[model samples]
Target: MTANASPRRWLFVLTILVGSFLLFLVQPMVARMVLPKLGGAPAVWNSAMLVYQALLLGGYAYAHWLGRFQIRRQAAIHVALLVAAALWLPIGIANIAPPAPGQEALWVPLLLIASIGPVFFVVAAQAPLMQRWFAADTRAGDPYILYAASNLGSFAGLISYPALVEPALPLAAQSWGWTAGYALLVALVAISAAARWRAGGEAVGAEAVADGEARPALRRQIHWLLIAAVPSGLMLSTTTHLTTDIVAMPLLWVLPLGLYLLSFVIAFSTMDRLVQTITVVAPAGLLSVGGLSLLSSGGGSMMIALSSLAMLFLVATALHGYLYHLRPAPRYLTLFYLIMSAGGVLGGLFAALFAPLVFDWVYEHPLLVLASAMLLPLPALFPWDQWLGLKPRAARWTAALLVAVAAFACWKMVDGWTGVVADVKWWGIVIFAIGLLVIGWRWAFVPVFALLMLGVGGWDTVQESFSGMRVRSYFGVYTVTDDPEHQQRRLAHGTTLHGLQRTEAGKQLEPTTYYGHQSGVGLTLDKAEALAGPDAAVGIVGLGAGTLACYRKPGQKWTIFEIDPVMVDIARDPTKFTFLSECAGDTPVILGDARLQVANQPPGRFDILVIDAFSSDAIPLHLLTKEAIGIYARAMKPDGILLIHISNRFFNLEPVLAAEAKARGWSAAIRIDPSPTGDDFSDLTGSNWVALTAAPQRMDALTGGIRPRKDSRNEGVWVPLEGRARFERWTDDYASTLPILFWGNIIGDRE
Candidate 1:
């Protein structure tokens, strides 16, 4: 090792870059491989993130402990640990299931840890520890640039998962490929460790003198945790909101996370001027568009789009930059990173683990926004800092009155739960005017600007989003909407349209929306007489708006299996969808998981069962498992058929159905009905329906009466999904939302 900067600097950069790249690359690749086994849902990604964060924190802690040793000892321990972790190589989860049934929430995390835990923990600590080693081995260079290289590697990995690894390889092949990369990573670590070892005996680098023997303050440590946690949690929350409420397209989730990673790149880079500029603008960004935190409102709001992206990038960069500024000396570098990693893990726990149980919907987004505002220092608009002299009492009162008026204006501005308001069209003019008048006082500016955002976009129809008028479950958000003649109820998870129904005078039960006459559900029910004769037994899984109830004929037994009680409550309320009242007035809606309930039902219980259980982006893996299919097969009569609704924003699930059927020796074919373009509402929705049947006679009977349109083909390769046979059967025993996230192509094709 020489003092010359040329070769050594390049070597340092290359090592950091490669290590970081491999670290981030594995995160998405492994996640994609586990999708089918886990279940494709947003919450699954959140869980996987938690695992990554937690492992990262652990790795940092390990690094911190190792750093306390001599240079040779540190290198020796790292080499040994890396080799030890490699023993569990070939990078795949263990073939293990939960000990008891119905414990997926608990078991998924444990399975994930058992599978990839050791491998990830070792790799995660490398960035911080390696940079410290570089600093200690070569005492002349600034290690901050290595941080930039590390993030650059991370950015590459995140980008590569969707663009290269997933599309290019299958799940099994991906595991082997990642294993090879892990081997290469081991070699790279060896090289770095060798470099450190060669740096002469007793390379004890400089140590900080203790002015006071006290350890770091508890408040500082908590602040570090908060700073890292807020942005990381918000990044996930933003992705959840955008995918579910804003736009449910492919690459949408990656965009927010990519930007989040990009923030770290900018924050840690040597370009101080750029960071300074962005930080200066971050406050204005937070105040201007921070109000529209609703997932229902899409990201096209000028203020929101700009401010949200800006605030996220700026605040994230600022906080990360602060972490870099307060970076511990080389002696304690791992400790600093350990604290940062812990913060990241905590953030994920709050967003993915705690929020779902606590808040009915995603509250992490607004909470993050408020946190960003507090962390960013504001510029003084007036020379006088005095609260009293800032603005006159009468003027302050007038401002409050104006805000109240604006709140009224906001109430009027909201067009629908789904669409943005018109007031945002003139938001710049409004915010600018308010900004001019409320310059000096923090309270005056913050509240009024927030009010203006509310009037323009934020508070519009918020009462509905909050008043339980909408229901967000593991499935998606269910809302009741009204038009001129017909009142409609819709369920959307991400951009994928799940289920919907219409009502006459907002109470008369009618099978509208996708289940209308034009839909396959409607067609099947319309010919119920020929299929099963009068008084046939019928079953529907998802009770959204209870539209399927309208298809019940006199003397027919109509049974529904609905998961969320909130949905049942909404449909049962006269103000919501009254399919139960207008259709099957006396029928009972069964509560609990549909598969569990149906699996336990007696044989020959139903002539037909329609599965419409998905909400938002969550596809219940348990319901689709092979064992569950056996239950469905047993529950229905020999002549009965099952209709599965596969319309989703982010996955190509037809293959899953096909594979399951193939494994069971049952037959399955898909039907694609295009949504009609008109104001009828009943005919204006698209659907992908897969009909499964064991008996050929029943299959023919089901599809014979309806006209067959050309089937829309999914271009991706269809692997045989022998559900739970190839992997852990998601049962009451064990399930996970950790690995089943395929955020690709949320919307398939235009109707």
Candidate 2:
């Protein structure tokens, strides 16, 4: 049973691939399953990521410690651990109830750790452990190449979950599929262990490899940690940037993470040419695209999103290629991975936890980009010593001049001293090109790059800082902007405009934006008295600048439910947006998730219930599920109307609502309001709203004269649920946005 004759190498590779695939696959799958329970906030995903990173670090440490034992003993212990962990399989979160209000941060991680901790720990260790086993058993090649295979499997799993798995399979099927994969991985591990045992504990280089190489120094280890830390932090920052600023969808999460893993695949592969090419071009990608993204305040959001993703991939590739170049010998493989995982944890902590508390903006994104530039390999562009005598003094003077210029530029831009220069986008491009050429000089490159980031985007940060216009919370970033030209003020969440108001003192009570007097929600409110009688009791799910409050009548009892406390504060403060104070003063506002809060209310209490809760373009899936609809139904009077604000940039949710309404035996009417025209002071924007009621007469009365015509998609206007057979009714057990995503309109929508 010599090493050369044994087939254990392939066995080990298969085991690593299967284990790593399941490891990354379960991440998004379980997170998606728990999204409803956790209220669909992006912070829940971040917290879940932290838990995974911490567990991965622990798993790596365990592998490194187990390296002290003989191969036979190590295999036995790991197999036993895997077997014990399998008891928690058919992987699903245990019936740990949703956390109490305000406890989501603590409880999300607690529940994840309790549900999948043991299983995740075992699978996480497979990569490093199997690689070590290969190093001990074979004398053929470096064992580290197998790491590329592991990441390849990881990339495949992540991409497939969103593109293939999620769209095709429900949660129950995905869970069982993952369980089957885990079982196969266990069998592969057993076979690999038996192969090692058959080698009679005298495989090639078992002792020699361990004693052959010197341990990496503390300085070198720290360098490895820093290199690994940059990409890890950058990955999370990129995810936040896209989801928070562009679109808050789960599909967006997979893009950055999949690219991040793919970088490892490309960097660690046998393709030396590809790695070298990327390493050469990465700095330019960061300088041009990354710098522009930071500086520009407004552009086509899809273009910005694509550019940002490209920048992330290029930067990650260069950083990871450098890491591969610095790899230690096979003897220190587990130790190397352990230190790298530790850096990953620190990076996750900084982006997900620290940045929100320390900075009012998404400052981490540009900061990490700058850090990536600093760490990139600086190849010499010209021979400075030969051309200019005495290189040291010339370098020192050059560095000082660049720093001074960068500082002066930032000062001028931030202080509004550069009036016309700031308006020209080409000026920033020229400066970025100069910065790219200076990468040969470390001192010059870092400062020049930092300056470009500040000059392009620094003024907005300065404006926000001085005016206190931006607020970051667990939900996302909210900015209050005053448009002097339009004589209006707006509250925006990410790229989506939440609410707007006329700036004139007397017009502050008028509703604007999507809630204008003639919009879908507006028309529904206008007819509320006719549909539900005088003095109707109303409930609103989302409190966006409190615009809906303007629709309240004198004797109406209106209540609003909001999840983020920061939003509640902004809406209630009269100086910010006066819709709440000017109209519905002293109205009761509940601070919690809408579904949960509405469920606890007295049954049959409200004449109308409005569902306006959304994060950017994301429809909170939890709110639209059948169970959630049931809860809303229980809280409403028998003939009460349900006004659902389904206007979104990335989803056509009318079909979804129609399907759900059909299942509940409720008649529905959809109103697609035309955009306002010709000096209309209402500031109305086009909107789509669906009204559901058990009483058909009420729907007919509310939708008077707004005949629903069949659209190009053959989707009829005000048609019964039978025409929506292509759409599935979402429930607590299953839902997928794949079928309804507005792919053709992604570029036009500022989601």
Candidate 3:
């Protein structure tokens, strides 16, 4: 910037940075606050994400609409809107009633919009609006550079929440801190408004153009829309693909989004050489890392995850850099942003809304990966024209030949993986060699990428997705597969195994998977009659294949509570798995969030209450809160045993439960059934179960009355649960997955 402009320049940059920071910080903060109300389903996060995208589009449109007014008039209106939005100070979830069973689809958006809609809309407009105002002088030296600073602030806010803010302070503190930031933004906006106080300041660049400037051509404008949408859709799709398909790592959801926001920072920055380098390398990333990351995450789940992330960053930066290359002058700045935001919303809709409804698996990830190949700026890796010098007709024929080769290579690759081809490894090399040759040709590159995808594991993913064996619900995607060799059928939520049952005649009656005979819940189920009398009234939350139903006695009255109706269907269908049909065929399955539904159960109704409602590796923070403990305590008989199955690969949930149990003075015991081994290992598995009871003797009975560890080695030995130090007591107001994360366990070769 010129020496005359430093003061004004820094102020405008700071204001945009601050506003952008607040705009992103509110997302995780408010989403954390609402978990208690909505339960910790991954869909809740997806819904919240879609709502934010829609709101952002609205904010950008609002900014574009303001271009019609003079600078002072625009400033006055924005400031007034900011002040009025202050009524939603210390932002959090709204006070409205929680959604009914199937109404969460409607309720989550309503709740989010009602909570922070006004404040978010006002702050979200700051980046584009403030940039436009800064350009009022025409000497502000390319107002577009501030967009880099805006996304930088956005990246910082998103990363800092999980790393610095949430771990350091609770949700309430995060919210009030954001509110304070908003107040400062209001003052900053007023100061920016005062910087240029010329009444009827002919709108910046309102004067006649330099004979060549007008709106971007219709095709160019549409290019901007599509260019913006691919990365936006890929962001969410990549998150789902990595977490659910590759590795069910808790809190990994934030990485894709963080990289996405940072891409704009890199792309829009003044570092032209860096942008040029990423653009050049991105096509290779699409060819090498993109489809390969999805084909088969075989020996390297971690490597696959890292490569996929690298691919996302490279592709996003390259596409967005090209967007910067096509940018218009400052006159149509807000229009450009409006179209960009609209595209973001559309992409978000495709990934978040469209995929879940239309496909059973995360095809959007691979589909967008293909779409990236189509939209990415193609620069020749080598002198294709000089090297080949082929005529147009020859080129077309060669392209057709390449298409056939790609299809054959992909098919062979799949055959190799399935043992149909003798040299699978050679097939991969051939596909890679052919793909590398066509990196500069968009038409040729796409077919290679698509075929290469199927050659890897994309073919299997496609088969499974469309086989009608997978089901999508508000909660998650569940797939039921028959394991004939193991004589069992398995149910899976993402890569995490939900449950499996023996398909054989006699063994089908056994409770397998996490509820093996020696498991804590298994032992408690066996001795429940001794502890709570014969015909014990039992309630089980999370009906995963109804594996625990076999633990029910002839006279025991067992009730199952399941949140997802799709899961219920899978469990109840005898054709899928017979655990529910054979054991609890007549049992009633209550639907809704386990916590809310448990709250409505008649007092002292259950003699043995079990909380087992986990979906894959992600544990529900809301279910383990003290308030939820109170609900569980009220729903069970005074001396009844409360069993919780904390079988999560992503979290060490003992601390959350240990803290609540300590506070309530409940007797809690921890049991570890180390994942089973030998032939039964595939069906029966180890589980971490915590048994708590208000009555000490009941705990003693569950623990074998001061049991000795001298029992059979295969059986789990109950030990007193020790409270973890310096742990947060999760509540409706505050809960974070950072504390209890099994960071090392995030990557593994699991089914």
Candidate 4:
């Protein structure tokens, strides 16, 4: 409030805003920098989040400790820290070598610490530190509102990286550009310091408060931690769930995180109405969306992704609104933020470090949803409680009735119903509508939500999960199920079907799914002897149930390169997929990243090589870069054929491949295999396979299978590719999925 302080208010706000922006911008940038060294699995982003949270906790603790110093000393110390951290600027991943297999989990944090630890720490402290300084200088103002501005800047940074920064600039440019922003942030922090240069140890916004307010109790601080942890863990779980259907690229990676930061904006703002409205809607959305998320997600990629994000925003806003409401006076502000950061680290560890090791499915998703239900401040919707003395009366009798109805629906979905659900929908609606009567009451509503979740899909997981049908690794979760009706065993990663094999006695020897007989890889392997001669050598990347193994010619040398050991086990086990066990059990299976492993191989080793890899329907960005292509080229003979399975649910990668081919003057063509709607549906999947070769004669051998285009349609034939505009050359330093993200495919129906 003083006129002198009014002029300085936006100065502190600017300092906090700039610092927070640079902090978040570096997170995704550095993660992308390290991506090639590891791999493009969704878990990689989750691990990166754990590191960010750990650093944030340290920053908050540092700010809280600084509160004990005099105002001028506090400002001086923070500025000194900022200048010191700047020595590590032009932020990039450390020059460390890639981690060994099974070492990615622990090694990721160490790598990040070496690279951006000091920069992120000093920047993260500015939000709380600047606000406290503003309060001390202004004499009286709610500095907490500045927290809203800080997160608003964070939302901007997260969103802009994927949308603007990444598509327009390369990694090297992005790094130097962020350094410029850090320099500006440093200047702003110094100006703020001069404006608040108080000499004595003024106890404003610090311990021994100016207002005589007591420190918050230990029990209450623990409550704050629990509340903050739910949304933190739930946000990561939602990201995993969404990317399972969409592609696991940075574009989609930023959406949930941006929303999470945006939630903090609303929760800490002066806009009470928006916060109240979201609080009223959050619990209901949690139950409804939570149930569908646990199931096959009621619809396509777009619908599931939208609903899950909405659920996260609503839950985050509701819980953070309560945090803002329970906030201590300005004296304990730093301590409050310190506790909140600790909770964030707890949640990230649970989801990123703990979940993959503990459970097979994304079991944390449902559990976090349940945790939200328990912690949220739910109020009754409509006048149901007002209209009813009847609600309390009904609660006694209807609890039993609702339980019985839930059990019946569970039966329809599970044991006796056997795929028919004619009556289940109406029964579920009736039970849910009745369950809404006790909206204000927590104890009654949670059971109804839990039982309804079971009826919808929980019981299916119970029966399906414990029977050894699911497995998890750093890459993703794998589910295996036998289709007794068709006599085929199936393998899936997330919602994407990776491979399947027929178990009909002698038919088990055939290859299926993406490698169907009409597929490009299929057509090339069929003519393997003609193209590479009798003793042809073959190398394959990504052993997904080893479906491509059955394509082997007798006495041909076939080799498998798989990154995930879990996938190796799934394919090698005779009990899982018979293709690898019976067809290529004796072949070599190398375990490591495909690019690195292929680079280590001797030059001109293979006559034919196939790249068939998927991390939950996402394209491996590292494998498609120019350097990676060069490594692959070195491993193959001059006349060798490279078959890359480019099928993806959320990206159209033809342009990227076309540009790579153009840069090297290699000839390339594609085959599109359409899945049928009939009896053979289980045995085939729609796919896009591109074949590239430096030698034109090698490509001609596979393209020769179909009649000329003048005589017939080029169905199952390799169509030639040419580079188009906006097709930037994809190198290790410069690559983006934005131009090729299949936006229409993600928003439209699943093709």
Instruction: Using lDDT, give the best candidate's number.
Output: 3
- Residue pairs in candidate 4 whose N, alpha carbon or C atoms collide under 3 angstroms: none
How do the residues 47-68 of candidate 2 rate in per-residue lDDT, one tens digit apiece? 8999999999989999988877
TM-score of 4: 0.94
Candidate numbers, best lDDT first, in rank order = 3, 4, 2, 1
Off by over 4 Å in 4: 1-7, 97-102, 138-140, 199-210, 245-250, 296-301, 389-420, 677-682, 705-714
* Over 4 Å off, model 3: 5-7, 97-102, 199-212, 293-300, 388-399, 414-417, 420-422, 680-682, 706-715, 746-751
> Mind giving the per-residue lDDT tens digits that candidate 3 earns over 1-751?
4657533888889999999988888898888888777777667888898889888989999999997889888988999999999999988778998666568789989999999999899899989998888878745567788899999999888888888887777777888888889999999999998986663333444332442577799999999999999999998888877767677666677889889988999888889999899998888888887766455235337777888888999999999999998888777889999999988998999998888888777777888998999999888676454578988677667767777887887777877686854577778778877777777778888888888877877777777766788887756668888878878787877766788878788778887878877888888888888887888999999888888888877888988988787888888888887778887789999987899889999999999999987766667778888788899999999998888988776788888888888888988888888876687466777788888988998887678654444534324678766567887787766667777877667655443
Please report the candidate that would top TM-score against the real structure: 3
Report the Cα lDDT for residue 370, model 1: 65
Candidate 4 lDDT by residue in tens digits, 89-132: 78877888767767877887788899999999888899998888
For 677-706, candidate 1 gives per-residue lDDT tens digits of 666555356667777877877767766633
lDDT for model 3: 0.82
Question: TM-scores of all models?
Answer: 0.77, 0.93, 0.94, 0.94
Per-candidate clashes come to 15, 2, 2, 0
